[model samples]
Target: MAELWKSLPSWVRNIVVPVLVLVLAWNIVTFVFGVVGALLAMLVKLLVVVGIAAAVVILVKKAAKS
Candidate 1:
């Protein structure tokens, strides 16, 4: 491995390697953001359902008291 690396030109070693690393890092970050966005969307859906349920319960209770 060391011998192979040493055989490569200096420009390739410096430029190509860093560009590959940056691309890989960007892909990883994009995947993480996608997962977080999905989770947040699910949470918002749950909150909306809970809010609607609470409103129905309150209305029912008020009607019963009347």
Candidate 2:
């Protein structure tokens, strides 16, 4: 494997390899960010639902007291 790598042209070893590494890293980062974004969206939705439920309960309690 070392012999095979050493046989490659200088451009492939330097430029192409770095570019490929960057592309792979970018893809991994994008995927992780997408997952985090999805989780955050779900959390926000859950919070909104809980907020609305709480508001309803408060209104009902207030009405009962009146």
Candidate 3:
């Protein structure tokens, strides 16, 4: 394999090989970013829910005291 790769011209080794690798990996990169974005969005939603629940508890406590 190394011999076959070495047999190729320098332009194919330097530029074409890297470009093909990136093109092949592009879908994988996009999938990873999409998963991360979804996770972050879910985390934000959880935080918002917790905040609202806390506020309701506080309001209930205040009403009970009064």
Candidate topping lDDT = 2
lDDT by residue (tens digit), candidate 3, 1-66: 999999999999999999999987998899999999999999999999999999999999999999
The Cα RMSD in angstroms, rounded to one decimal, for candidate 3 relative to the true structure is 3.0
> If scored against the real structure, what TM-score would every candidate get?
0.78, 0.80, 0.68
Identify the leading candidate in terms of TM-score: 2
Candidate 3: residue 7 lDDT (0-100): 100
| Span of ten consecutive residues with least summed lDDT in model 2 | 1-10
lDDT of 2: 0.99
- The per-prediction CA RMSD against the true structure, in angstroms, equals 1.6, 1.6, 3.0
lDDT of 3 at 11: 100
Ranking by lDDT: 2, 1, 3
Itemize residue pairs with steric clashes in candidate 3.
Answer: none
Backbone collision tally, model 3: 0
Q: lDDT tens string, model 2, 1-66?
A: 999999999999999999999999999999999999999999999999999999999999999999
lDDT of each model, Cα atoms only? 0.99, 0.99, 0.98
Return the TM-score for candidate 3, rounded to 2 decimals.
0.68
Per-residue lDDT over 1-66 for candidate 1, one digit per residue giving the tens place of the 0 to 100 score = 999999999998999999999999999999999999999999999999999999999999999999
